[model samples]
Target: MRRVPDVRPPALRPAAVLPGPAPRRGPVTVALAGAEFGWGSSGKLSAVLSALRERARLPLRFVGLASGLGRPLLAEHSVEHWYDLPDAAADRRAAVGRIVRSHGVRAAVVVLDGAIATALQAAGVPTVFVDSLPFLWTEGDRAALPLDATVYCAQQCVGLPPECEGILASVASLRWVEAVIGTPPAGSTGTPGTPGTRTWRKALVSLGGLGAPRLPDRTAYPRVVVPAVLDALAEHGVQEAHLAGNLPAGLLGGLVERPPAGLRVTAGPLPHSAFLSELTRCDVLLASPGLTTLLEAGRLGVPTVCLPPQNLSQIFNGRFHSRAVGVDVRVVWPENVFREEEALGLRAKGEDHALELIYGGIGRVAARADGTPGAAGLRAAVLAAVRRAAGGADWGALTAAVGTGGAAQVAEALLAIAGPTPARGA
Candidate 1:
C-alpha cells in the first residue's frame, strides 16, 4: 500500500522535546542610561550594551533616559528612543515610570545613574546597575544610589581605600568585576616601543570629564593641557596627533593654535569606537585619567599618560595607574594648585568639599596661561610624562591588574535578571 508518507512537514517541525515559555513573543526592550557628568558612564554603558548585543538570547531594542552629555556619545549604538532626563527633580519618578510602561521595558541597565535606576526599579522593572566608581562613593552619595539593585556590579579597583570602606560591601547583590571595557578590533594594538630609537608617529590625546555640569567653564583642563601635550608629542617625534573630547565649540581653534613645527594637531570629540580605534593605533595616549579610557587604552597595550585628573574619580584613577604601573605615569596639577593628598583628604568631609578644591585649583591654573610657576610646572609635568611614555616602558600593568572581562560578567548578570516575570510573557 502506497501510504502517502504521513508528512505534514514532519508535524510542522516536530514539537519541542520540552515546552519552553513560547520563546519570547517579541523583541525585549531594555532601558539604558549613563550619568550625565561625563563620558565615563556612557562608555561603560557602551561596553555593556555591546556585550549584551553579543549575548542576548532574543532580539533587543534599547531606549535611553537621562543620558545627557552622553546622548550624543551613544549615537552609533542601537538605541531606538531617547528621552531627556526630567527637567524637574519632582518629576523624575513619574517621568521614568511613564517611560518604562510606554516602552514595555522588561529590564534596565543603568551606568552610575542611581536616581534613574531606583526609579525604574520602583516602576517594577528589574535593573542591573553598574557602579564604575564604587570607590568614589561615601555616605553622602548613599542616598543617590540603589544599593539593593537586582545586580550591582561594582568595578573592582586597585585598592578600596579606607574612605570607601563598606560602600561596595553594602550593596545587596554586589558583584565585583574587572574593567568593563569594549574589545578593540584587530590591528588596533600599539607597537612596543624601543627605548632609544622609537619615534611616536601618532599620539592620541583624550580628555574626558570635560562637560561635567558643575563646571561652567569647560575649557579649563583643555586650555592648560592641550598645548602642553601637543608640544610634548612633538618633542617625542610625534608627527601628528588628535585631541578627542567634548570640547567647547570655539576652543578647537585655540587647541590647534600653536603646534610644534612638523606636528599636525587636530582636536574634537570622537565617538566611542572612533576614539578607541585612535587609541589602539597611536604610539601614546595622553588623557584626562578617566578609568574607562585608561582601561581601554591599557587593554590595547597603548602607552598612556594620565593627564592630570579632571574630577574626583580621576584623582584616584591616576594614582591607581601609577600604583599599577609602578611608575608615576600621571601629569599632575602643581602642588601649589592643589595637592592630591589634600583633595583626597577632603573626601572624608564629602565629595563636594573635595571638588571645591579641585575645581578652584584647576580654575586658578587655567587662569594662569601667562606661564606662571604653577602653570609652567603643569606643562613640564605633562611633557615629562608623555616623554616617559614615548620611551617604551610597560604601561599595560594597570589593565592587567584589573582584568578586562568585566563587560561580559556584567552582561551575564543583567541577562539573568532580565528574565521575563510571571506577569509578562516569557
Candidate 2:
C-alpha cells in the first residue's frame, strides 16, 4: 500500500495532535452549515456536532442551513436554529450574517456548502470546510470559499490544490460508527457464513435520500425493485433483510405489507447510532453509493452492493472508494427506470438543460438492468461480491490507510481556529 500522504496545514502541523483535554469555560456557539443534498451530509454533520458537544464539555449551540429535504432530519437532531437559504447570493450572505451575529457564533463547520462557508468567513467567523469527496474538489470550489482549513474524510488522498490547506482522515462516518458500535473483535475475520458456514442469511438494503424533490415519487423504485431483490435474496438462502433510508413511512409501510415469502423484511429510518450498529450485524449491505454508507459498511467489513446511483458524484465515489479498498462492489444499473412524467417534472423545476442532461445520463446507465438477463446478472454478481467480501477483504489495511479519530481531529482543528476558550467570570 502506498504511504498515506501528510496533507495537514502548517497551522495544524503538530504530529498526532488531538483535541485538547481542557473544557471550555463558558457557553460557546458553533454553526454547522450542512449541504441540503442528502442525509449523508447532514447525518455526518450531526454526528460531528454531537462529538464536539460531548468532548468540549461546553454549553454549545448549533445553527443549521436546512435544505428542503434536510429540514426534518435537522429538526430531529435538534439544531437550535434553522434557516432556509435564500435564492440570491446577497440574500444568502445577509441571512447567514444575521444568524452568526444573532447567535454570536464563534466558529463554523461548513459541510460541502462552499458558498455558506464564504459568507461565514467574510463575517469574520472562523471556518472549516469538510470535503467528504476530495475527488470532486475543484479550484473554483476552493476559490469561492477559501476556508481556513479543509478536511477530507476519505480512505486515500487525492491530492488537493497546492493553495488549499488540507487534512486527510478516516471516513467520519466510520469513526462515528465505531465509536457507537465498538470495534470489531480482533482476528474476527469475515461475516457470518464465510466459506464453512451456511449461506449468507442477513442483508441490509438502503437507498439514501432522493435529494431531488422534482424527480420521481419515492415509491417508484421501491415499488418496482424491492420485491424482486428480496425474492432473489430469499432464493439464495438469505432469510432476513432490513431496509432503511430517508424514504417516507408510507412507502416503507407499503413494502412491509407485502414482503416476499420466506424472506422477512423490516423497514424504517434509523438514527445514526442505531444504523451503524445494525450495519455491524448484517451479512451484506445493499445501498446507494453515498460515501457515508459505503465507508461505514467498509469499516465494519460488511459486504456491499451499490445500486444505480441518482447522480454522477455518487457513481464516481462508489467506483473510486471501492477500488481504493480492494472491495469489488458491484454497481447494478437499472434500465428504463424513470417514467416520462418524472423526467418532465424534473425538467420543469427550472433547471431544464442541466436536469435533462443528468436525467438522460442516469437513464442510459439504468437501462442496463432492463431484462431478466440484467436482473439475474445483477443478483448473481451481488452474491459473488458478498461472498468475496464476507470471506475477507483486507479491511485492516483499508482502515489503517484511512486512519481514525476523525471527529475529534476535526473538532481539534475547529477549536484551534476558534481560538482559546473565553475566560469565565471572576
Candidate 3:
C-alpha cells in the first residue's frame, strides 16, 4: 500500500543569536489568531505581520495558530512560532493564556475567528479583529465578541459597527503585492485597448481559494461556470486566458485540458508576484466575489465580472464595489440558489436588522443568475462587461477610495496599542 505524505507544515522556531550584552528589557511578542479558510485570510495576515515586525523596530516574537492552509504561508513569511489551539473552550482558554504568558505577548491580531478573539480577551490580551465581512460576526453566538480594534476591508464593509475603534482599508494582500511586484503608477488605468482593432483580449479567471461555499456542493458551481466563461471569452475575441485559483490540481487540469478552438486556457496557482503581474496585463478579471481578489482587481484598475456568490456577504460586496467605482462589474448568481421565503423567514427573525443583511438582500435580487437565460445569456453578459472594461476602468477613483499606506497605518496602530517598548537601560 502506498503511504500518504504528511501535508502539515513543520513547527517553526525563532532565530537564535550569539551571546551578547543582555538588554534591560525582554522581547515583546504579539500573537495572531485566525482559521485559514483559504489563501485570502492568511495572505493578509502574513503581510500585516511582516510589516509590523519590520516597522515596530523592537525585539518581536510572532505566534500564530497552526491551521493547515495558513501554516505553510506563515512559515514562508518566517513567523517565529505556531501553536495548535484546542477545540474545547476551557482548553482553548488555557492554551491562549499559556502562550501569552510564555511569549510575553502584549497584544494579538485576530482575523475573524471569534472563539480565539474571545479567548484572548478573557486572558487579558488586547485583541484586534481584522474583519472582511460584516456578517461573519453573526456566526455561532459570537456576535458579542469583544475587540480592542476592528480593521474593515473593502467598500462592502463601510458603516459596520464601530466597535472600540475601526480602520477602513483596502485588501491587506495589496501590501504583499506591492512588496513583491512593485507598486503601479498612481492614477494609471489598465492597459489601453487598440480601438477598431480586432485584437485578442487577455482575460484572467480566478474564482478564489474555496470557490462558492453555500452551494450544496461548493465545487460544482465552478465546473459549470468556468467552461461557459471560456466559451464567452473565445467568442468575444479573447485568445489567451489564464485561470488561477487555490483549486486542486485535478480540478484545474480538467478545466484546462479541453479549450475552445483557438482559445488557449492555462490554469494553475501562480505565485503572488506573478499573479499581480498577470492582473496588470489582463484586460478583464473574471472572478468569484472574494474580497481580496475584488479589491486587488479594483486597485489595479482591471475590469471585473463576479460569478454568483454562494453566500449573502459576497452578494453585498459585489454590488457595493460595482456601484462605488463605476467599473463594469457584473455579479451573476443562479436564481434558485436562495429562496425568497427563506430570506423572508430570516428577516422575520430580525436577523436582517443589520444593514449588511438588508443590503445583501438587495444585491441578491439585482444579480440573480437566472439560468433560464441559458449559457448564451451568461456569455453575452460577460462579453459586454469585458468590452466596457477593456475601454477603461475607474482605477484612480477606486484606488483613492481604498486608500494607500494601509500596511503602515495598521502597523502604527498595533505598535501604539502595544505601548512603549521596554527600555534597554544601563
Q: Each model's TM-score, in the order given?
A: 0.90, 0.74, 0.72
Arranged by lDDT with the best first, the candidates are 1, 2, 3
How many pairs of residues in model 1 come into backbone collision? 0
Clash list (residue pairs), candidate 3: 308-332, 333-369
| Runs off by more than 4 Å, candidate 1 | 1-24, 187-197, 368-375, 421-426
- Please state every model's RMSD to the true fold in angstroms: 10.3, 7.0, 10.7
Residue-level lDDT of model 1, residues 1-426, one tens digit each, is 011111111111112211353464577788988987789888888888888787765677999997879866788798999888675666998998899888888889999888888888999989989888877877766777899899888776776765566666688987777788987877665543345535679888888887876875788877777777776677677898988887787989877977789899887788888887777677778888889988888788777889877788898898888777666778777677788989887887678788888888878877875633354566678778876665665577778777787887787777777674333453
TM-score of 1: 0.90
Best by TM-score: 1
Better model by TM-score: candidate 1 vs candidate 3: 1
lDDT (CA) per prediction = 0.77, 0.58, 0.57
Model 1, residue 375: C-alpha shift (Å): 4.7
Q: Which residues of candidate 3, in runs, are more than 4 Å off?
A: 1-26, 71-75, 135-144, 147-200, 209-216, 339-374, 420-426
lDDT of 3 by residue, 228-331 (tens): 78987898888899998767667887788999887899888765445667888887778876666666666676667766553444555566567655664564
Clashes (N, CA, C under 3 Å) per candidate? 0, 3, 2
Name the TM-score of candidate 2.
Answer: 0.74
